[model samples]
Target: MKHLLLGAAALAVTASMALAGGHSVVRMGTEGAYEPWNFINDAGEIDGFERELGDELCKRAELTCEWVKNDWDSIIPNLVSGNYDTIIAGMSITAERDEVIDFTQPYTPPDPSAYVALDAGLDVEGAVIAAQATTIQAGFIAEKGWTLIEFATPEETVAAVRNGEADAVLADKSFLDTVAGTDGLVMLDRMEAIGGGVGMGLRESDAELRAKFDAAITSMKEDGTLNALIAKWEVASQF
Candidate 1:
């Protein structure tokens, strides 16, 4: 599989125009591939932590919201291009990403990153590691000077491990749990939480929209509603 490098984000130079005042219908984009956080359920609807959280946020922000499913690799650029007003895809908050898009305060706490493979143990430093493109895990592998194989979606990374295309797949421990413990794949008994909490991604120019969602996220964080959702999805640790 061809792996795209991080420079793909350099295309997100388009500035978002100001949204009209008042609560207009807003569009929320998600990968709909990463489970528990966001995924397509049997009915083919977007269902998961982010779906519920995004809906509640829109209600609290007093905006009519619609869901937009986009491939993981293009989510950010699409948001910058006005394809969506907000990104509720389980996107991590990082300084590199912050330069391209702004983020709301964390809704889900950081998750431990894990190495999982068909083999129980592998040489992380020398083994080929698969990670979803544009994620913290992918960056970590590069920073560690390890061979990194990038995929457009989380499922593809895991599949690479299963297909013996990669030595291991590095991703959120919780996400890997859904695949590892059940798919004959095993977690490497080694892992690390390498980034901050997951948050909503908005265009850098959408300060007003970011603020509105930030306030809504703050409300959730204050009320224990966010904790309930965290437990509900079993995605990661709570704030």
Candidate 2:
């Protein structure tokens, strides 16, 4: 009888430890400048679709989450170096990127891509354009007679255009909406349909973590929570 009781206690302890390990705090990284997806506000607070979605996923997964801001160019490297566990920025899951980091099932659908002008009379047609390096935007720019000015983040590219350092910037349609009516920028032209769907990035070894995130995202989509959050961020119309 004593042996039986001892074995039961051991099982309970092991189960408790497993549960504790499963709920470990997850470190999530974002650009904190991709508005409607993730961005830091003027008051230095992080807000947007990805931020809210991260919070919701943490709640559903029963895990604690910490949000970190980093340059978009370094986000993948940081994750690979263990600086962050997951990426919640407006990162697209592309075949090229898959060679480095794993991605959760995409939560957002691909939105239209556009080029925006910084000043009036600045004909973007056949002018140099800026976009975040290694993105689909760069490929699109390569097709045009436009020289590519690669920035570390979308916000930086937009800043360059706003400051007249670049003639135009290429980014998602929702980003154009967010930047419109500010910095005297206006949409120049819409380009070939580009995929800008957002996903969570994880290390290749962290398959379990990726699974949890993917499951949570699927649930959110099925129940309309994802759509609601998109609407709250004022980006649903852009999709």
Candidate 3:
């Protein structure tokens, strides 16, 4: 439940060293908790839009890749520490994050941040907002000087609202769609656009790897494969 507005700055200070690179198999790190973006399936394997897209990207890059599920709170630290080679999580590209790590051209377009609450008329200005820790939504709340409560995972944020611990939960609209309008929860009409878009996170020293994935993503965008995947996942509007 740490505020990324603060944690991201700390990350920039400490994440100065890069891990030695020479691995034959590239590890793709993800939360595996955010569905439609990345999640653990019935087979207990990583499956979702990023999983599908990442596999194809690896293929195009001619690199062997494997998926690694890491906690969202330490995803970036682990990547810089060489626990993984790349992050394929649904992480928004931001200036604060860019200071600590490198990102490829966005594969997914910018997604709208939305608030979901039990009642449609919740006064957002005075409302207690719940958001997943270290996310753009949480940072946005902190930046706005809103009454913010953060949780370790996306589910916890929704739970905070359902339990009356918060007035509403703010998160990615696509992520909220799976739960919005269910169990008396409704997504508000208002939306906040935060961050640039979702992209692959890499260590600053991994220029070659970053370039490979960037090329692959660019090719996907040019060929409309990326748009097709976006439609299939309903993650965001297509480019």
Across 1-239, the per-residue lDDT of candidate 3 in tens digits comes to: 11244355336544333332467798899999988798899999999999999999999999899999999988888887778889899887877778888899888888888899998998897899999987888878888899999899988999998999999999888889989978899999999877678899898888888999999999999999999999999999999
Ranking of predictions according to lDDT = 3, 1, 2
Prediction-by-prediction clash tally: 0, 0, 0
lDDT of every predicted structure (CA atoms): 0.82, 0.72, 0.85
CA error at residue 61 for candidate 3, angstroms: 0.7
- Estimate, for each residue in 36-93, the C-alpha lDDT of model 2 and write its tens digit: 8778888898888888889999888777899888876566776776676888887777
**Of the candidates shown, which would achieve the greatest lDDT relative to the real structure?**
3
Against the hidden reference, what TM-scores do the models get?
0.90, 0.82, 0.92
lDDT measured at residue 153 in model 3 versus the true structure, 0 to 100: 90
Number of the top-ranking candidate, with TM-score as the measure: 3
What lDDT score is found at residue 28 in candidate 2? Answer: 86
lDDT for predicted candidate 2 compared with the true structure: 0.72
